[model samples]
Target: MAGYSARVRGDIGRWQQAGLIDASTADLLRRDVEVNARQSLSFGSILAMMAALLFGAAILIFVAANWEAIPRLARVAALFAVILGGYVGGAVLKTRDHAAIGEALWIVAAAAFGGSIALIGQMYHLSGDEASALVTWGAGTALAAVALRSNPLTVAAVGIADAWLFLKGFDYYSRSDFPHVFVVMAIVLFVLSFWTRSQPARHLIILSLLFYLVLLATDQATLPVAIPLVVASVVLFAAGVLVPERVDRIVRLGGRLPLHALLGFLTGLAVIQFELADEHTYNSGFTLASVVALAGIVAAIVFAGRESRGLRWLAYLGFAFELATIYVVTLQSMLDTAGFFLAAAVLLGILAIVIIRVEKRMKDPATGGATA
Candidate 1:
């Protein structure tokens, strides 16, 4: 049997060498031959998912059964324990073996169980100051993510806590108190990014960026065009000068939420300053600089096309913003209806062309590789 198999393999190898098949086609065939090499689920993952479902259901049943009997403090403690236990168990299992999906499942189960615990607690009482509880839970979840190297559950737990903080902070937004939750979140996510032991770490970092941007936006900072430009400029400069030049880190840390927020805030400011009736008559220096800044941003987009999807999206957004700025400037200043309509037609045509190009790129194998 072995000899016959070797003979067959030798025949195929000879056929490939004799120009009977192209390399790409041959490679595809080889891949097809080994298609089942992919692992669908290991025993560990199956066990973990089952455990997660069971634990989740058990927690639900426990709460439903003891709806009124459980003390408020005890319920809170129970919730915290479930989350903590899930996190600990998941982390321990993952640390022992890194490539198990069960680790992620366990962490998820923990969070689900934790949620039930929280709801149960809520039924009896919410603390006079719930921020402490939120912070503690968020911090614990983050720690578990680190220990277990599970990204999905870590993100899920962090996001839940962040959402709670956002709502809580909004109650005090009038007093200019933005949730400092991002500071903790940033530290936790930064640590996770460095670990990079799991695919979920990237997700956690992305979520962290998102939350940080939300924090920045909701904060009391006067979001004029200058602020975001300053932020981008400063971060880019500092990242260049201070941080070691790791491309992935630089892109994640530099080009993520802050850049997006800066673009959004600046674009918004542009709309506010130029698009309105009375605001159109601004000084020439600022307007020229704004145009230059916007143009620079577009140029950066083109340059960064291969580097970051966020930047590519920003480019589209920046162009739309520029057009909006122009429309407002014209409406407020000249009010030439025919000219405006013509400009709109031209802009739409440009946008259509750009979209077609983008769609083609998306379909292309080159630009739309693994990252895309």
Candidate 2:
């Protein structure tokens, strides 16, 4: 397949030579391998994007150098001209099949739109409401992305909208307006994710929703906040296990949301642990809650480690921190502390061995013992 790495191709060829797979099967496998790897931008595309950034920076510098000399009308005209030129050039290049360049130009156009909004506001001596300006700019970019069906532009729009929400949320913490706005924006972006079928956009939308949840947590009681997060994490992980294909159809996230939820749950548990430790009581309800949370986190780590390497690492890190913190808070004598660490080290070594064996078994059940 065009997208297959050399090592993968070699393996396929060897399988074909060994008659494990027929030529027709090999061809079908190759055909099934999608060619467009969108996880990273191509080198040329990255260079084009960098070039666009530098060009935009140069234009800004030029305008700043002649700020006082240039008439206000001329300045406004120049700004609009740059914005118009970027969109027109991008459209033309896209039609001509220069997709990378066109994408870069569209990014430039989006940036120019933001700059124009700020400049126009300054020219009119408008009152400073940066949040409103960001919202307007985001709306414009979203419209452009919808019209052009541009993934990069959609990403830009989401980022702008996120910034606006963050600022507005901070500014109106007691009003409950920003949260509603964030919810609406999140819904719009979710729909856009399905329409555009952009993985990056979908991930961004998920992150935005997570951020909104965090913001809401800031207003509620800490224990209540932790409870919901823990519950949501468990539910999300269970959903991933039970209906992964359906989850992928709805979100196109490929089991990542469960991992993210797991991380969030662990983080919330950590926060609760620290909050309890701050109470400085050895036999209080907080202490008991902390212990329960720790055990739950450990169980989650063990369960997730069986399937996901990333989640396994996160679990390891979280468990290590929790164990260290618990020992520091609960142990008094230096000898006892040192013994605790020694026991922990031994347990971790055993865990590593078990994990390696599990991985080997998962990779090749028939030869698991031989491989180990």
Candidate 3:
């Protein structure tokens, strides 16, 4: 929000200089923005948030260290007091026009809620697993995020959910039904992002889905998991790059959906390349994978690169990894390796030409954004 405020101010100045608006009107707009920007995030507020997180951690650690010394009822009272104080104090601060600071306190409360769940479980000697406890904590935080409309709390919930997913499903071959619930968590968080407007949470959920898919592909020798990953990634990227208007109509992420979709495409291609490396037929399999990976990266640049710096960077990273892996696998074949680099150079040169042309046209007002 602070960044948004700055951009708005910059644009206002530009508009004023361009004579798009009168000086008086510009001053009025600046005043309005300045007044509203107080509620947005600032450097000090971020520090306060971090301080709240540290304070919560310190309290939890102190209590745990003296758990046996303190009376059980007093311990329970202290935990509840911590949780209530966080939320209530946050509300008070928000009402006093400290929105970011209040939200930071909400995060402290959320963390305390999770810690209390674990501590109470220990105190009662309850019979339940860590996965369940983490899930419950995440769900509670999510509910609080909804009730409070908190972006920070929503992001925190997504983090907790990812921790649970990784803890329970790091071994994809395990017989853990809990890990399979990641899809539900992803869907819920994705939908919840719209309500809380926590764009980071949306990004995290997408990454979580991709991480889970990669794990799902791991050790599933019976199924061709890489194929599905590649297929899905391509479809998603195409939907965003080709039919962006339609995709954005539903996803409403401006240009971010395509950026992340391209990332997913790269991850899928990387998975394919590595899965093929397992077969020992590195020449054929890796070459095929490299070709596909190169194509995907090029398509990203040609299609969505102009709008997504993230997509462009991801493509660059994918190209580097693809080249390195193929080089490693084709070490025995000097002729093949030389041929591969020469071909890659040619392709990249062509891509560079295309990019140069696109930039030229983008700079030319007559051509505008028609390069797409």
Candidate 4:
């Protein structure tokens, strides 16, 4: 009864407030509302499940019916229509305060439609050939997702486009051919982040990072183009550290760790080492040392700005470990011999002391944010 009367009681309360219902009638209405609300909730759940099943069946039917004759354009058109219809239905129902069932139905219906369209394309040998078709589908799906404010569809579109680009690069096109596409994809991800209100922007920022990675680290034409990449990242990091009002909010909103900039810096180091590997005897060791030193300096700067002594300690510890590991590796490379664990132990001892001193200086306990 309590469940059933919820909506009715709410309406009755509003009516009472508006002087449309007297006290006795309001009480009666409230009781009936409780009973009705419970029943409706159950009914809504059942209806949503049924709609989901029907949606699946509709997709199956569409695939079976269009197996032989459907063209790519027509299939895509049908897919857009289905997604549009689902979103429209959801919006209308949600306005009536039927949010849960409406959202469920909308999601399932749109998914069924999108899946059916993709399947139809597959059956007709429409996918994987023309870049234009794939691009068109991706753009259309993304637009529909934005218009409908549907996270699932938006995420799906993002995945599809990314996978498409990856496939093209790895299997069909040369690695040199993808920097432009990756840049465009990054832009798309950032734009999508702006449109989403409820979803976390972290996912979008990560997606943007991935695209940037592909452009700078994967595509042969742009790979090792570190001058521009480092300059951009350094500027971003510097601003994120020095400018309080501008940088803090943006980085926090972007939900990225200042530490992850290490990835780009490491990549740049790797590129330099690769280019100089043949010309130097201690090439790998040199690279490792350079990275350790640079990382230490950057980490110090970041820790001071953010007041995160733990990260600073971690950075120093990482550098120590890398130095010890590289020393052992260099010896093995040159002399074809390996040292025992004693050397590693000694390095750890020194590292521990340095960390202790740093922690004391910062007035922070040597704990917290410690990874095993």
Candidate 5:
């Protein structure tokens, strides 16, 4: 098969030589395999995309440079013309099977939408509220994405929404409570990801939600902040583990929920470690919480590590960091430098053995002991 590796091809060649399969059959198998393999952009497609971006940038810069020279009415007309022309041309190209170029034209159209908003605001001498502009642009782009069913446009919409949220929170509502707008927009993008089946859109939604949570955490005091974060992380991780495939199908995350949950859990643990390790006096309550969190993290590693390589490595890093922090903060004097190194060596050696066993258990038999 065309998609098969060289090793596989070599085996197939051997089989053909041994008269196990005829030439025609081997060719057919290769054709079928190639057809089923994932399609990737050719070098020509990449070049076209690069050219499109440069062309779009040039058009924008040229228009901006001569913007004041053109009449106000003509400026508005030109902006709308570009937007309309881009969409029309893209549709025609798409129908003609020039998909890569058509997609590029659609991106140009989306960019024109933002440019039109800025131009209209300038023409009217409107207030320079970036958040409002971003919200408007994001909404418009989202509408276009829905109409066109374009993933690139959806990505643009997500970017605009994320920017709007960040600016709105920092500049306009720093002292206010959490921005519910972010939650609403994130939910919209989450739905769009499923509708569009776009992994980037889903990842963007995850990032925005995480940013919102971090902002909320930073708004509170240390211990109070740490508790809710830990609880939320635990809940997220639990849901990822317990939620069924049917639910994931409805959600259409492509199995990314568990990865996000793991990240959140690790983040919460890191925050707790920092809080407990920074305190001069080792309070009994803080120590207890730290121990519980650490144990939970280890348990998570043991339970989820085999299935998720990212989680496995992240957990190992977190565990090692926590141990180092604890030793530095509480046991530096009790255990001399040599003793600390000795303890670390022994602990790490045991951990290595355990990890190897787990990896072996999780290895796939069909793949001749290849790891999952």
Candidate 6:
């Protein structure tokens, strides 16, 4: 984050010097960078956080090891003490300018909160599933994050929410409420990313959402699943890429969301291709998926390559995966694969022209051009 911040600041400086942005605007951008950027975790600070995690793990182990010998009330008190001490000490340290370590302590506290929930549930013989317990822990940690404005806690909450989804044990075909609850949890974490200013959490949430969509496609009928994914992803791509000014007024993550949206679009197309393959429409399906994947790779580069290296890397990785899978899937029919690429090349040229025009419009101030 430090390196990113410095690079952004330098770009803003050059932009201002080149008369692209006024001084006041540049100052506002700098302040926004300072307030919203995640504090970089230095090597020593990372080690300190690791140490804190180890200490917390040891505490949990010792408590569990002596569970029968320790009185029930003492056990509860000990867990609460650790939780309370972590939070209090973290707040104190942050006030003393130990921000990184303080955030790490918050993570430790969140871990304790989650463990305490599970341990207490087991101790009391509570009648609830792991999913419910996880949701409770996630909710508690998210509230703590909101109260403390802690990014680490925000990340922990997102992880817990994802774990709840995976550990729910709900059948894919069952009309279970757990999946819906998980979506709610993911949405809440996405909203909190803005308040906590945690880009990593936001990035994780985006990927998790896409993963959830893919899971849906696998769990349900492909046509029904693909429709929703394509529609929703198109909307997201429009919001995040086509209208940056409007998206900036709402949520901002340095233009990464657009690439995620594009990924979702590709995933939806891939799902359809597989569905068609099952119906013995392999060649047509492969053509559709291949052409779209190629266009998606190009769009990602055009939209995000200039400003976001991470997004560019992910886009390339995703394209590479698609190509590799296509090759393996069509190994017995190399000539058929060649035909798909030939068709894709023609379609890509047309798509490239449209993308170039869009880029031109974006750079034209009269066309409501807005730069991030």
Candidate 6: where is the Cα deviation over 4 Å? 5-44, 169-178, 280-283, 333-372
lDDT of 1 by residue, 1-372 (tens): 334345545546665787787778767665544442332344566576666667677776776688679877786677667666666666666666654544655655555554654575568575634555566556666666665555455655556566665666567423445666566766665566456443344545555554455455445443443356445554653343334256435455543543443454444445334424344365464465457656656555444454456556766777676667666654535657788788788888897788568746645765334223
TM-score of 5: 0.75
* Candidate 1 Cα outliers beyond 4 Å, as residue runs: 1-66, 69-101, 116-126, 172-176, 196-219, 223-245, 249-278, 306-310, 329-343, 354-372
Q: Candidate 2, TM-score vs. the true structure?
A: 0.81
TM-score for candidate 1: 0.60
What's the TM-score of each model vs. the native? 0.60, 0.81, 0.82, 0.59, 0.75, 0.77
* Each prediction's RMSD to truth: 8.9, 4.1, 4.5, 12.0, 5.3, 6.2
Ranking by lDDT: 3, 6, 2, 5, 4, 1
Clashes of 6: 0
Backbone atom clashes (below 3 Å) for every candidate: 1, 0, 0, 9, 0, 0
Best of the candidates, TM-score: 3
Per-residue lDDT value at 47 in model 3: 95
lDDT of 4 by residue, 130-165 (tens): 454556656766776677675545655666566666
TM-score of 6: 0.77
lDDT of each: 0.56, 0.73, 0.80, 0.57, 0.72, 0.76
Stretches of candidate 4 off by over 4 Å are 1-86, 89-114, 122-134, 150-153, 172-176, 198-224, 248-260, 274-278, 282-329, 334-372
Per-residue CA lDDT of model 5 for 1-372, tens digit only, reads: 133444566666766877889999888766655554424344565576677667777777788999989898888888888889888898799789786788778778777878778878887989866677888889988888788777767877898898887876675634445566788898887787666556678777887877776665666565566667668777767776777475467656656566676667666655666666656474665466557757876777766666677777766666666667666777777887789889889778866886677567656543553222
Highest lDDT scorer: 3
Lowest summed lDDT across 10 adjacent residues in model 6 is found at 169-178
Q: Please provide, for model 6 over 1-372, each residue's C-alpha lDDT reduced to its tens digit, 9 standing for 90 to 100.
A: 778789899989978987999999999999999875654666777787788888888888888888899999999999999899899999999999988778778878888888898899889999877777888998999999999988878888898888876655345234464375667778888898889888788888877777777776777677788867877877887687777777766767666667777778878877876766554343566666667777877776676555555556666566666665565465436547777777567546655665566456545653343353
Ranking of all predicted structures according to TM-score, beginning with the best and ending with the worst: 3, 2, 6, 5, 1, 4
Could you tell me which residue pairs clash in candidate 5?
Answer: none
Judge candidate 3 against the unseen true structure and give its global Cα lDDT, from 0 to 1: 0.80
Model 4 Cα RMSD, 1 decimal: 12.0
